[model samples]
Target chain A: EPEVTQTPSHQVTQMGQEVILRCVPISNHLYFYWYRQILGQKVEFLVSFYNNEISEKSEIFDDQFSVERPDGSNFTLKIRSTKLEDSAMYFCASSESISGRARDEQFFGPGTRLTVL
Target chain B: EDQVTQSPEALRLQEGESSSLNCSYTVSGLRGLFWYRQDPGKGPEFLFTLYSAGEEKEKERLKATLTKKESFLHITAPKPEDSATYLCAVQEADSWGKLQFGAGTQVVVTP
Candidate 1:
């Protein structure tokens, strides 16, 4: 089965440095999303992208965070000036459609573990 | 605000045992309820999606049922391979693709 793929399974970065997490969602998927999981915490939604634009974002997706579909298959999330609290597992997901029943189920990538020191 | 609460944070089951995991959610307008399985350090794997109340779906030994306020994942005759963290998430009707997730229930099946 086709699955979402992410680059750099693990990343180590220093505080105040920038990091870009990349994902290639399932082929033919139309909607993409970014979510994070802090250690021992629930998965939190960051943002959703469709049609080369942001559909919705959470408070956690503040000014420092940005997402881009730099190419047809590459979707990237950039964080400017990472903080210690930013250390978490960032996941990328995609879905085929959002309107039909049960069509919104998303498939997630293996996730990129970001460690900020 | 949407809130998802899962009961019994951890469960230990013997091989061939059967049990259920509960996910209760509060959302403005329910668009869909999803169930995912996650192993340690891995992303969630999609299992089933329940769109409306009274809807149910089954896959292998796993069965998921949805109600107006809660959803349940029943594991029947589970094996050691069934051990994993089961995650439940919700999507609001008015939202695009954002999913609100619960803390998840970790299951351990021993032989």
Candidate 2:
């Protein structure tokens, strides 16, 4: 089965540095999302992207965060000036459609573990 | 605001044993509920989607059921390989594609 794929399985960056996490969602998927899991914490929604624009974002997705569909197959999340608190596992997900009964299911990638020192 | 709570933070079972995991939610307008499984260092893997109170879906040893305020994931004759963290999430009422997820239950099945 086709699955979402993320690049740079693990990354280490210093505080105040920048990092960009990349994902290639399923080819036919339309809705894309970014979520993060702090060690020992629940998965938290960051942002959703569709039609080359942001559909919705949570408070966690603040000014330092940005997402881009740089190409037809690539969805990227960039965090500027990483902080110690930014250390976490960042996941990328995609869904075929978003409505009605089938809209709730989200297929997630293996995730990129970011470590900020 | 939407909140999802999963019961039994951790569980242990022997191979071939059967058990169920619970997920309860508090949301204004119910859109859909989802179930996923995660390995130690990986992202969540999609399992089932439940839209209505009576909806149920199954695959392999896993079966998922939904209700007005909660959802259950039943594992039948589980194997040691079935050990993982199971997560539950709810889609918000007005949001088009955002997901609110639960903390998840960690299961360890011994052979």
lDDT of each: 0.95, 0.93
* Chain A accuracy of model 1 expressed as TM-score: 0.98
Candidate 1, residues A87-116: lDDT per residue as tens digits?
A: 999999999998848578899999999999
Task: Give the RMSD in angstroms, all C-alphas superposed, for model 2.
Answer: 1.2
Query: What are the models' TM-scores?
Result: 0.98, 0.97
Candidate 2 on A33-56: residue-level lDDT in tens? 999999999999999999999999
Task: Write one digit per residue (lDDT tens) for candidate 2, span B11-101.
Answer: 9999999999999999988778989999999989888888889999999999999989999999999999999999999997688688899
lDDT over C-alpha atoms for residue B37 of model 2: 93
- For every candidate, what share of the true interface contacts is present? 0.88, 0.88
Docking class of 1: high
Off by more than 4 A, model 2: none
C-alpha RMSD of each candidate structure in angstroms: 0.9, 1.2
**DockQ, each predicted model:** 0.88, 0.82
Q: What TM-score should be assigned to candidate 2?
A: 0.97
In angstroms, the error of model 1 at A96 is 0.5
